[model samples]
Target: MTQDKTNFTSQQDRLPPQSIEAEEVILGGIMLDPSAMSRISDRLSADAFYINAHKDIYQAALRLYSQGLPTDLLCITNWLSDNGLLFRIGGRNKLASLVDRTVSAVNIDVLADLVMEKYQRRQLILAGTEIVQLGYATETDLPVILDEAEQKVYSIASEHSASDLVHISHALADTFTEIEARHTGKGSPAASSGFYDLDNILGGGFRKGRLYVLAARPSVGKSALAGNLALNVAKTGKMPICVFSLEMSTDEYVQRFLSSESGIENNFLETGNVSDSQWQPLSVAIAQLSEQQIFINDESCPSLNEIRSQVRRISSHYGGVGLVIIDYLQLMALDTDSRVNMAQRVGEISRGLKRLAKDLDVPVLALSQLNREVEHRNDKRPVLSDLKDSGAVEQDSDVVIMLYREEMYNPDTPDRGIAELVVRKQRNGPTGTVKLLFDHQFTRFKNLSRGRSF
Candidate 1:
């Protein structure tokens, strides 16, 4: 039994280290090859240089043979280099000869000790770490591992449900901080800069993270009204914002901003009707805006991922993004050219925007096209159903706001120029309407009459 134990140890020692065993030390204690580890490490996407256990010429040859390379010294060095572990060439054949020469003289215990020592030496040389310490060694005793805050963020994820439940826990708790006065919860409580009665009815302004869709017939100031609200937020420094203009250029959009800031009509800017004295206000507004963090990304159409990436970049570089405005949702790109209905594609886009808002913890304001059913109705005012393409928009949004100017459809009416800000759905608050004053001169809208007095 004693002789059998000796022979068993000797045989195990002579059999050579398994590629899986070597990799066990390289990565975690589990078995894996370098290629497998590399893939598991996401292609080693960042620049990182680390060393591993040193192998003898015979062991190197075994590795080379397993990897389908020539069993020669040069080939061994080249293989290591190609696979990202590198060593000098001259030592290989000498070590191989030593392995064959010293095999009988070497005891199993001595060889194991040598292998362990060499691993420590290599790790010490490559990484300036104390191998004996609990958390600093690489080659032996578990690669020194540490956790990062950002990685912890990605490592955690929950099993998503097969279907969504709309029962948002309305338990406001204390997560709701009063961003404005007179509001005790998370929903928008500031009257939109439209009409006072409308503000009182709608219970304030647009809610955070809610997708506000505005649709209109051919040319009923869609851009104008959207621009007006966006500029109001910018001018007031209300919150960090973004404007995705699918239909206009940055230059044209700037023209609209200039009109709003100067209280000058677009017609004046286009036809030179503005007096020279008015240039001062435009200049001041321009200078002030240059210092503010309001952003405008005017791509004709952007994919949801592309937008997410852009938002990530903006947030990282610009100290976080707040409000996001998409000119229209129907223009968003569908994931693929499968013959899916427009409504499904719109739903996907709407869902994506909502997720993005929650993920980034910001509000998303999107413009939408109203179905012609709105036009056919006697009221001509848009309702939740009039939202183009997707009823999902109403379902997913915390608030759904639609714009309808009575004058847009009727040439001569008492409400001629009166724009109604209808809150079609308030996921967490009262649903109602607000009226806004549409000033053609500035091409902007404001509360009919209110705070800081327009």
Candidate 2:
């Protein structure tokens, strides 16, 4: 009797954790009511089934439902036969068994949850085993192993959080409500960069879950523009803006903010040579900025993974990080063991930044330096192609703004001190240029005054 019990326990352990009865119920419900498939699609997938026959049948049902065809018992059987999977899936007899076992279609969602739960448990077992193996390995760095283990678990969690589709009518109703609120000035809309003309051209403001790229040649004021936007967003006090400066120090960033806020020359502030008239504005600027919520990190080099982790930490403190600004894109790092080209690494970094924005549900304003090729051109206007290192930078970006100043090329031109905010690529709106006055002394960008033509 003891030997018999041991044999039974061994057989049970050999079988992967799964609920075959629940899978059958889910498949049968879909056959009984085609609409049941739509309700459970987001919660379960074919791989969730432990039995081969059940997996094949569920796949067929999905194909039929997706093709706008019925998923009734006969249709699924015929689909399996036509696809040459019927015999492999235990033929018609097994299909009939599923229909007989299912009592009702009302609890399809509940059955799907059961199947998903079993599948996740199996996944956890596998992931835990891998972690154990990694713990035993002595060659790999402990930190790297830990990172990989965390990523494995995160992937499972992320997969379970699949998005559900909303009906068009419901989506439209929500949009209409938002519009009404905006019309009445009742809603606090997405944060803007505080430049009215630029915001107006952008259809309101920098929306959540968007990646905006600002590229310019050296000294054209991309970093300054990023700082200006950061300061403006923080001034609202609705949410904090986190700026990661790879090139500039935190002190330099703060000084730029002070000069921009006080309309005082950075040179005067840097040397503590402020005039009597400038001291009052400086003090006021200090007081105003000290009241706002602005976070800055001037880490010289950080990988994409590190940046994501840091952003998540900062976001956990308050409502969340409303906006993320990276001083430049090319400065960010990526991990790769294989021999990849520079452009490919840059592409990976760009795509990672876009994913980070969407995952955090916030706008990421990343600065980039334009290629030197722009200088050889006659116009010297930076274009989308000039985004250094990778073409994916353009492909992944929702909006691309380039900075142009003819004064840099020709000091005698009347456009001196005027920076052109060129909307080179806008996915959801028109592309045009909005001029802003660039005061290099204060390291600030301001909306051009009305009736003052550039």
The whole-model lDDT of each prediction reads 0.57, 0.83
Q: Which lDDT tens digits does candidate 2 get at residues 89-180?
A: 88888888878887878998888988888887777767777877899988987656776776666567667776678899999999999888
What is candidate 1's TM-score against the reference?
0.58
lDDT of 2 at 278: 85
At residue 409, give the lDDT of candidate 1. Answer: 66
Q: Per-prediction RMSD in angstroms?
A: 17.2, 6.5
Worst-scoring 10-residue span by lDDT in model 2: 1-10
In candidate 2, stretches whose alpha carbon ends up further than 4 angstroms from where it belongs are 1-161, 275-283, 333-339, 450-454
**Residue 144: error of model 1 in Å?**
33
Q: Write the residue-wise lDDT of candidate 1 on 225-336 in tens digits.
A: 7777676655543456688888888888888888877777878887877798988887887897686567788877777766765665576566666567888788774433
